[model samples]
Target: MSEFLSHSHPRVALIGECMIELQQHANGTLKQSFGGDTLNTAVYLSRLLGSAAQVDYVTALGDDSFSDAMCAIWAEEGIGLSRVQRLPGRLPGLYCIQTDAQGERRFLYWRNEAAVRECFTTPAADPILAALPEYDVLYFSGITLAVLGEVGRARLLSTLGDARDRGARVVFDNNYRPRLWRSVDQARQAYRAVMHEVDLALLTEEDEQALFDYADSEAIMSAYRDMGVSEVVIKRGAQSCLVRADNRRYEVPAHPVHNVIDTTAAGDSFSAGYLARRLRGGSPQEAAEAGHRLASLVIQHPGALIPRSVMPA
Candidate 1:
């Protein structure tokens, strides 16, 4: 799915935010971490693919201690940071993750002033936007669109078109957050516009239903196929993920977990593992298995990013 690159290992950019995340423990203590959808995918994809692929995060953050930590962590993961911008006097967003006993989570955000809001609008962004077309793959989510505002969204769409013209594949993750949008219709219009540019679509069925009021997973898959996306993946949290890659559809089940401490980056890591495996010459079925393996372990942890030491060797 997506426009498969001629080269096995290609340069890829994951565009989005990386906020300071605070996870509230049951004891009412807060543990700090950093996570954003595309950033999560970048980290895991780099770790999973290692030398096989080049993964980079595309976002802007403040020149603060928290941003320093984020950069240090990314460097440690071997993720390229050429596209990560540091705006002075501004800081990254902050969010708190609160979990229920069953391991479900609710998030509280305080990110309105995050530096990423100007990621694409800044004067320095011209070079990065121009360079995006040269990458083999560009991955982003609805959250990216939401944070960029209308003008920034238009600029991004123009770059995506330019990238596609150069044969760069566009991968989209439908992480819909209604609160971030002006209205459902606005988000729908934005999603529809970007989906047309997407080649490989990674979707969470629950998110699709929430945003589009789709009757079922089949409906969601049909919509993406109608948009001409060659590959569509429907992730159903602890259930099976439906993959439509290379003109074949496979229902791949998630690994059953006894204890899911947190599920912040479960889907993002799954996308990474899947993409990494596929790029490494694995079939869709094999890639899905790799995705599930990584995601299950991610959910068993407490934050969006887990220790690299705990990752699969």
Candidate 2:
């Protein structure tokens, strides 16, 4: 049974940064939007679950026009902003995406001084940190760890431990970006510190290899299992995704997408779908299938977010 199914309306909080996204078109045009790995998942999860759950985003953003716009959009999607902190005189990070002829996207970031770097550290953040353990589920990604500097990361680790002790399920996604961290060793250490407390781990095989240099899929699963993660899903692009939980392993084939316009938020959307279904009392196999279905539709579009009308039925 899904843990969330026991509650009337599960409260989910996803902690990460949402940056100003500038998508460079082939015709030399730039389109502005807001996107981040965990933010993408938050939006998708809110969309899929609707009033079935209370979805919230936990991050600090500047009291600026861009931040205002991002919050407006998230509110339109029905994502709660009670946990979002608006810091004065600070600004959200920015990133630009350039896609090639083959629809492969590359990103350039300007996030060194983003307001979210002070996410869990500032004086105003004390209450937010205290409130995190009250949520039924807390979701974050590797990128979340990277943005929260050393002090913030330490605070997050202590909070996660307390959250888990209070019976809150901790979910993690390995959305690793090498450019975000100071060093591989530092990233590894930070990841390991939180892994022991994670209940469900959504991993990308490529990231596992890049970060840990795992020999193969089995090694990655074994490493996560050793860290005490109860559930692990290894996402392999264009191939089947593997899920291991309760000492059983299953492989669900990916939904085929013939026209891949852009693969921007494939993994993030998959995580959202999987978590949505799993939270709604779906089996692990059903959750993986939901993940593939949403990811297939997402990659057919050009940007991270597909239109609300085109959502999978």
Name the candidate that leads on TM-score. 2
- lDDT accuracy of residue 110 in candidate 1: 95
Q: Rate the local accuracy (lDDT) of all candidates.
A: 0.90, 0.94
Full-model lDDT, candidate 2: 0.94
Tell me how many residue pairs clash in candidate 1.
0
TM-score of 2: 0.98
lDDT of 1 by residue, 53-168 (tens): 88888999999999999999999999999998899999999999999998889999998999999999999899999999999999999999999889888999999999999989
Instruction: Quickly count the clashes in candidate 2.
Output: 0
Worst 10 residues of 1 by lDDT: 1-10
After superposition of all CA atoms, the RMSD between model 2 and the true structure is: 1.0
Give the residue spans of candidate 1 off by over 4 A: 1-3
